[model samples]
Every structure is written in structure tokens, then in C-alpha cells.
Target: MSLCEAEKTFILHGVEENFRIDGREREDYRPMEVEIGIISHAFGSARLRLANTDVLVAVKIEVDTPYPEKPSQGKLDFFVDCSANATPDFEGRGGEDLATGISNSLSDAYRSSKAFDLKKLCIMKGQKCWKLLVDILLLECGGNLYDAVSLAVKAALWNTRVPGVKSVGIDGKNVELNVSERLNDCVPLDVSGAPVMVTVCKIGEYCVVDPSAAEEKCSSAALVVAVSQGNITTVLQGSAGSLHPTTLMDSLGLGVEVANQLNIALMETLQSAPPHFDVGFLK
Candidate 1:
């Protein structure tokens, strides 16, 4: 967690007036900064900062044999690494559990066929296919990790450019093809169903969105809602304690409403990002 009980009350009161601790409204998202194509070695890369939490996502595309069961489809894997820079508690593999949890959650969120189409990445029937590895690096943990990570993933995907295929020459004994010409060409991935995770903290019977560390500690429990295109993708209950059924439902509804607005703001921001935008850090 990131503030104190008094600080939380101040934030809550600000929210009640449609203002936030950062001087934004409940509907207004924190100033988001994005940087694309930052990694020269990776196929695509992006860095996103939402208030304090900073997340970097890089896309690495590789060629591999398609899975036997899903030969016609490609694969998109998600991996989250919790860097020790965020906190000392994550030192020496101590953060493995949390890292794995975040990665697995992302895999589940994108596993549905309807969420992300993989067939477009298939090159051969069962021989070769493109696999996209999405690696997420956590730079800071000032709170609101879920929202920040999801936004970074979406931006990285948008910046991704899959290498195009030149030609396919298959022989009975050995199959050899020429692909050098198409190495420079690339196609962008469609991320329309990119899901956003919204956390609704239940603090003294009131729900708070995007809580800071202190606000998180002040709350009894929280609900994690993954929403894609205004639809509920997944719902997870967090915090150290449990909650009443009615409160859970209320949190979910609030999350959905906030998620829709968040998605819209993200889309607008990405669209407005300039081609040669600068990375804003130390901010």
C-alpha cells in the first residue's frame, strides 16, 4: 500500500466532490505517460505510467511449431516479473509467488478465443506459427498495479509489428522458404478486447477506485474486476478479509462502470500519442 487514515479520509472527501488526491475527478484518470519503441532488441515495447505505478511491456515474436490441438492457431503468452526495485520484500525470489499469480491471471484473462484471435498469426497448418511473448516489467509499486499493467499491455500490443512472411516453399525431404524480404514488413495486432482490471476498495462501507497504499490499508477488503469492452471478463475478491454478498455485487457494478470509462480514456490517449513522443520519468 501508498497513504494514512486521515489521508484516506481526505481522499474520500475529495472523491465525494468528484475530485481526487491528485486533483483529478473520480472519472478523470491520472496523467498517463507512454513511450513506444523503447527497446531496440524487442519486436515492440512500451512503457506506461499511471500516477505512481510504472509498467513496461515488451513484445517478442518468435517462430515455433503450433500446438497439436490448436495447430491452426498461434500463441500469445503473458509473463509478469516483479522487480526488486519496487520493494525489498521482493528480493531473492521472494516475489516469485506474486509474479506467478499476476502472470497466471493474465493468461486466464486472454485464454478465451473470443478475447484475442490467434488464428491470424498461423503461418502453416501444423508446422510453423508465430508466438507472441508479452513480458511485463514492474518498475514501481505505488499502488494501482492492475490498471497500470493492463494499460501497458494494451499499448505494447498496439505498438507491436509482426514480421511478414515472404514465401513458402515446401519440399518432401526438407522444407525451405525465403523470408528475408518480408523481415522489414510488419502487421499490428488487434487489441480490441484488451481487458482492464479495476479495483474497488471497500473502505468504511464506501467503494474507492484506484486507491493508494494508505487507502488500501484503510480498507477492509477489495474487489478486482476485469472488464473488456464494458463486459465482465473476470471478478476476483482481494484483501485480507471477506465481504458480504451485497457489497461484493455493488463493488462489481461500480468496477464495471469505472472500467468502461477507463477504456475510453485509454483509447483516446493512445490515439493521440505522437509518433516521436518523449518518455516522461522522474515525475
Candidate 2:
């Protein structure tokens, strides 16, 4: 949505005062709710609601040949789908560009060995491996989609349970594998190092985390920071506006600080959550 000059001024003034339109501090985030194992058909699934922004993530695993260049490692792919109803910008073909950008950002964030270890997904040397496809569906867009998507993706990966292989038989060039049918014979993914992203928006001279839709329009530029294990993984710039070196550094610092806090809170919620059926997905 386009903001008028008056609305922009109001948002800018609020940012300058370190208070947002939603009554959050500069570094404060919106309230969030997370539900795991939301998709019964998928191996792993999670739904996250950050204020008005909603995202659903599912992890689907398949047995496939490992890349020739990386024989010992498995493959991980990210795909983002934006529903037309999510936002006006998502209607028609406009959302494809945004979806592609978000997908690439997630891929970059998870490329590092410290971020996610693909070696654990390997089944048999170069012949057989587990390929994880992380599918993200955007159900709503209030703002800060990068952070919402990253959080949901991490939660989904944590909920994933990879089936165990009972036996692997090699017949020259052919490889035969038998996966365990028992539901209890499954291994959960290690997501301790998974990255979480935070969007720091530059409004006037100050910066704010988790900007609302109106606050986003009033900002000149924004930085998407992905942090893994308390370390910065990727920093992406948004909008055409340029930033001064000092501002860039400051934004990065803020992003890192908020990402660490977000990660801690998310882990605490996941660990303490009890087993329950997910009813949010249907809505």
C-alpha cells in the first residue's frame, strides 16, 4: 500500500522517537505464535504467525543421487509460493519476483557448513542420498516476510523426521535401499545451527526491527540479516535507497542482536510445547 506524505511523516516521527506505530520499541518484535507438524502428509511441517504475517513451511524428503561435485553431501532446495490473496502485490505475476528473491535468500543463508550440515542427509557415498525440499507458502503478508519465512522454515526443519534405512545393497552401478516402515524408527534433524533472519528498516535517521506495513513504506531502505548460532550468515539489502557506511554497520549490528534473541525465544517455545493437533492450517 502506498502511504501519503502525512502518513509517512507520522511513521518517521515515531521511528525517531524509538517508538513504532504498534507501540513497540526500535528493537522490539511483534508477538508470534508457532505450531509444529501442521501438515500431516508432509514429513515435517510448521506454521508461524507473526502478528498479521502468516507462513507455512513443509519439508519433503526423497532419495536421489548426490551431486557429482559434492558426492558426500546431500542436497537441499528452497521454494517459496506466494498466494494472490496474501497481498495486492502478489496478484498476477508480480509476486513471482518477490518469491524468487526470498527463495534465493534462504538458500544463501543455509549454504554455509555452520548454518546447516548436509552430510547427515547422505545415505550411501555418491550413489544414494536424501534430498530435502523446503516448501514455503505465504498465507498472509503484514510485513517483514523474510523474518517470518526464516522462522517458519527453521521450525519445520526441526520438526522433520527422516526415515531410517534398514539396508543398503550395491549391485555394481545399481544401489538398492530399504527404508524402515516403523514410525518410531526415524531420526530427527539437527537444527541447532539453523539460521533466523531479522529485517531492520531504516526510517529517517533511526532503524527499527519488525516494521509494520505502514512503517515499511516510510522507510528509505532495509537490511535482512540472517544469523546462525549467534553468527551472521547473510546480509541482504532491500529497496533502491542507499545507506551510508555507518548506517549499514549499525543496521547489521542491530540485526544480529535481534536475531539472537529471536532464536532463543523460538527454541524455548519449541522445546516446551506439548504434543497437539494443528488447527490453524485449515484457516
Candidate 3:
């Protein structure tokens, strides 16, 4: 399945002309499909398919005591699962390491105060706080996992609806949950400043955004940047081999530019999306 030297040169030549192998311009985004509330079991859910990369996000909430250090803030946790459905290499526990890596990276990307407002999720100062468990499922790894996962996270957060509470009663150190008469009423989470991740792959002497699987194999290095309203939330450098500092910086610059465009397109799609939209994989 590997490309020959001639085919590789053809790809490079196409990039030099500002047109890619798939006839896409540098700023053009691949066709994407998004679905919300797909999983009835989860409180909030979203499934996004970016070209070939498929991602599923689920949000679960629980009531728990706030942390001692941050009693006024709630919690938002990220957990990534690399399912075997994506590839045979991830069968059993073999993909645990990669799953942990993705989850930890997301934690670093979204834990900052500027990325998400956790205080808004707090109910009581030190007594009760809402803990959000954001779980991500990697159904397919076509090329860009970071970008796909971030998009899914934003979509899931948009679909999240927290139940409204009327009051909290405490008696004999036991807390009672009193919800409003409108049990079906829910409030949506704010996601204006949510971070969007972009990956820039360095191939030959040029950098490319949203590289294909074959292109990724030929790349010497890559940079992943999570941008929240033009601010950098997370910076990650990955490569099959080593890279120089100059090249790394150059790649990061390219990543930032690509990230901005990605955010704009995602927002546009979400704004015009309909409630009963159909998102099929075969599409």
C-alpha cells in the first residue's frame, strides 16, 4: 500500500501548485458530517466524521464534593478510548498507551481557565459540584485524530443540556436534591471559547494541513496546536523521526494558520445545521 518515489514526487508537485492530490486547495476543508444526540443512553453525545477520521463523544455528569484546592469550581475530565474497530493493532489492551496519551493531551489542552469555565458548573461552594466526564471513542484513524477529536468535543459540549435545580436541602449532613417542576427543561453549556486542534504535517520541505494516511507516513515531523479563539491552548510536536528547532517553529506557524480556518468552518457548519439532519457514513 506504500507509494513509489514517482507517486510521492507527484504529490509534492501538486502541493507546490497550491492544489493537493485530492484537488483541494490549501485552505479548503474536507467534507465533514456531524450528528448530535446519537446515543440515547448518554446525557450528551455527538458523532463527527471528518473525511475518513471518525470520532464519537459522550458527556456524563455526576454530583460530587468539590476539590479542596478549588472548592468553587467543578470538574471536567477527558477520557479517550482507542477501539479495535479502527484497526487490528489496537485489539485488547494494546491501544491503552495511545488512549492514555490522547486523553492526557486533551486534559492539557482544555484544563486552562481560558479554555473552559468550570466555575459555572459549580452548584455549591464546597458541598456540591457537577463533575463532567467527557469520553471520546476513536472509531477510525484515517489521518488527523487530533482535529477530529477536538471537533467532536465541541459538538458534544454544544449538545450538553444540564438539568435545572430548584434548591438543595441539607439535613443531618445528608444533602437532598430538589429539581424544578420542569424535569425536562435543561440548559446548554457555553462553548464559545472551546479549543480547536489542528495538525500540520511536514512533508519534504513543505508543511501541509489535514494530511492523508500516506502523506503522514512520508512526513518527517508534525505539530499539533489547539487554538481557543486565536489563543494557543496546547502545543504538541510529533514525528516518526527527529526534527530541527527551526523546522518545528515553522511547522507550528503553519499549524496556527490552519487552525483559524478550521474553527471558522466548524462554527459556520454548526450554525446552519438542522435538528433532523441525517449523517450517514456512506455519504
Candidate 4:
């Protein structure tokens, strides 16, 4: 979304005063709603709405051979699809670049061994492993896309249930396996250390989290930080604007602090969420 010069000036003054046009403080976030296991066909799925932004994520698993170098580790691939309904810029192939960027960012955040344990997905030393395909679909764009997508992905992963292997037989060059069909036999994915991403946007001389589209347009720089288990996993500069060393440090600090809070709130919601009959896009 585009903002006029006067609108940008107004947003900047609000930031300088630690008050946004929406009457929120610098660290305040918009109201959020989350639903899990919403897609019946997916192994796991989640839908998250942060204010006007909406994101859906699904996890599917398949049996595949483990990588030669990391025979004990399985694979995880991230894919992001931006629907034409999200925004005018997302129509046709316009969102391809943003989708790719989000996918890559997610991959980088989860690449660290401490962020996600791939060994949990291994079925055998080298012959068999469960490959997780994480698909993220953007249904709407209100702003703070990175943070919203990251939260939905983490929730979807947490909801994923990996099939149990009933039996495995290996010959010299071939292997046979029996996967359990009982739904109760599935194993839940462990996402305790999954990273939570936060975007800190610099407006005027102050930084803010969960910036609206108009607020985003007023900012010249932004930093996307992913934190897991109280450790910073990834720190990406998302804008072309360069930040001073002090501003960069402050932004990182804010990102980590906000991420910690977000993680706690997200887990609380996931654990307490009741069965949802109404799932999918909300009109």
C-alpha cells in the first residue's frame, strides 16, 4: 500500500512520540487470532491473522533417502505462495519475489541445528527419512508479513504428526518399511526450539514492531530477527537503508525482546486453543 507525504509525516511524528496512529505504543502488536489443524488433508496446518494480515501454513511429510553427508538427518523444505487476493502487487507473478524471499528467510532461520532437530525425522541411518514439506500461503497482506508468516509456520510445524514406522527390513541395496496407519500411532513434531521472527522497522529516529502497511512505507529500514531458545538464530537486514552501529544494536535488542514475548504468547495460545470448527479464509 502507498502512503502520501503528509501521511508519512504524521506516522513519523507518532513514532517519535512512541504513539502510532492506531493508538498503540512502539512495542505494541495488533490483535491476533490463531487456529490450528484447520486443513483436514494436511498432516498439520495452522492459520494466523495479525490484524488484517492473514497467513496459512501446512506441513506434509514423505519418505525419502537421507542426504549422504547427513545420513542421520532428515530434510525440511519451505515454500511460500502469495495469493492474488493478498494485494494488488501479489497478482499474477508479482509476488514471486516476495514469496521467494520469505521462503529463503525461513530456511535460513531454521538451518541451525539448534533451531530445529532434523534427526527426529530420521527413520533409518541413511536409507529412510521423513522429509517435511512446509507450505505457506499468504491470504492477505496488512503488513509485518515476515513475522506473521514465521509464526504461522512454527504453529503448523508444531501441529504436524509424523507417521510411525511399524517395521523396516533392509537388504544389501534395497529397503522395505511398514508405516503405521493408525492415527493414534503418529508422533507429534517437537517445536520447542523453533525460531520466532520479529520485524523492527525504523521510523524517523525510533523503531517499532508490527508496523502497518502505511507505517512500513514511512520507514526507510527494517531488521528481521529470528530467535530460538533465547538465542538469536538469524538477523537479516530487510531494507536498502543502512543503519548506524548504535541503531543496529538497539534494533537487535528490541527484536530479541519482542520475539521472546511473542514466543510465550504463541505457545500459550496453541496450548489453550479449543477445537475450531470454523477454519480457512475468513471473509
Tens-digit lDDT track for model 4 on 119-233?
9989999889999999999999999999999999988998889999999997878899899999999999889889999999999989999999888888889999999988899
Query: Candidate 3 on 25-85: residue-level lDDT in tens?
Result: 6545677788987888777889999887899999998888899999999999999989898
lDDT per residue as tens, model 1, 1-283: 4556678787667656765667654444556688887888888888988777888999999887889999999998998998998867678997788778677767766776666788988988788889999999998877777777877887788778888778877898455555554645778788888888888887665677887755666778887888887778777666777889898888888898988887777677667775336544223
TM-score of 2: 0.96
Q: For residue 222, what is the lDDT in candidate 3?
A: 79
Model 3 ranges off by over 4 Å: 1-9, 181-184, 240-246, 279-283
Q: Count backbone clashes in candidate 4.
A: 0
Tens digit of per-residue lDDT, candidate 2, span 166-205: 9999888889999998989999999999999999889999
Q: Rank the candidates by TM-score, best first.
A: 2, 4, 3, 1
On the 0 to 100 scale, the lDDT of residue 1 in model 2 is 93
Give Cα distance to truth, residue 218, candidate 1, Å.
Answer: 1.9
Query: What is each predicted model's overall lDDT from 0 to 1?
Result: 0.77, 0.89, 0.80, 0.90
The TM-scores, one per candidate, come to: 0.87, 0.96, 0.90, 0.96
| Candidate 3 vs 4: which has more TM-score | 4
Sort by lDDT, best first.
Answer: 4, 2, 3, 1
Could you tell me the TM-score of candidate 3? 0.90
How much does each candidate deviate from the true structure in C-alpha RMSD? 3.1, 2.6, 2.7, 2.5
Model 2: weakest 10-residue lDDT segment is: 274-283
In candidate 1, clashing pairs total 4
